[model samples]
Target: MKLQLETIIIFVQNINRLKSFYVDLLKLNILEEIPSEWLLLQAGGCNIGLHKMGEHYPNKSEGDFKFDNNTKIVFETDQDIRSIRASLMNEKVPMKEVKTFDNYPYWLCDGEDPEGNVFQIKQRKV
Candidate 1:
């Protein structure tokens, strides 16, 4: 048996806002969207699905669908890590200082979506 990871459904307060961040700021290709409901975007080999909180749980608006800090979405890029950080900085996107792990030998930086979903821009040392 084999399992393949494909889509990750993240719940957000505002679908449009997250959509714009992923589509406009991050320049991810929009796979599909149903205004105020959900939006799907191309994440290299995978797909990310963003769903509206209110649509899913009409009664839970007390930060129930906020981004989980425990999980970090990491995108491995072929581009230089510094270049990636610079591009994100040019767009005014909040990002932590890029650092390298001495043991693993990879450059990584943490960033967050408008709703605070932690994500990383990383490149393996080559």
Candidate 2:
């Protein structure tokens, strides 16, 4: 038996801001969007879905859904790590300093979306 992952839904406080980061900054193509409600983006083999928090979820009050600090979404890239880091910095995206793991042969840095959803950008060092 095989299981397939279809979409990853992230509840965010601001839909437009998160969409802009994925579309404008990361350059992920938009598959579909519903203003202030939902957005689907094409990211390689998977689709990333962003839904406005506390709006569409049933039985949820305003400010009920919050970004989880323990959740980290990672995107792997084949591009130059330094170049990607520079681009993110230029966009004023708050990011950690790019670093190499002592146990792994890759360069990685973390950044956040508008509402503080954390994500990591990583590139394997050649």
Backbone clash count for every predicted candidate, in the order shown: 0, 0
Cα RMSDs of all predictions?
Answer: 13.3, 13.6
Candidate 2 local distance difference test against the native: 0.71
Which 10 consecutive positions of candidate 1 have the poorest summed lDDT?
60-69
Q: Write the per-residue lDDT of candidate 2 for residues 1-126, one digit (tens) a residue.
A: 122344566767788989789999999998877899878899888778786765344542324233453345667777776787788878987777889856666687767787877676767788
Candidate 1 on 25-116: residue-level lDDT in tens? 99999877678886878999878878666533444333423334334465767778888787877887778898984575568777667776
Off by over 4 Å in 1: 1-68
Error of 1 at 73 (Å): 0.4
- In candidate 1, list every pair of residues with a backbone clash: none
Candidate 2 TM-score over all chains jointly: 0.46
C-alpha root-mean-square deviation, candidate 2? 13.6
If scored against the real structure, what TM-score would every candidate get? 0.46, 0.46
Candidate 2 regions with alpha-carbon error over 4 angstroms: 1-68
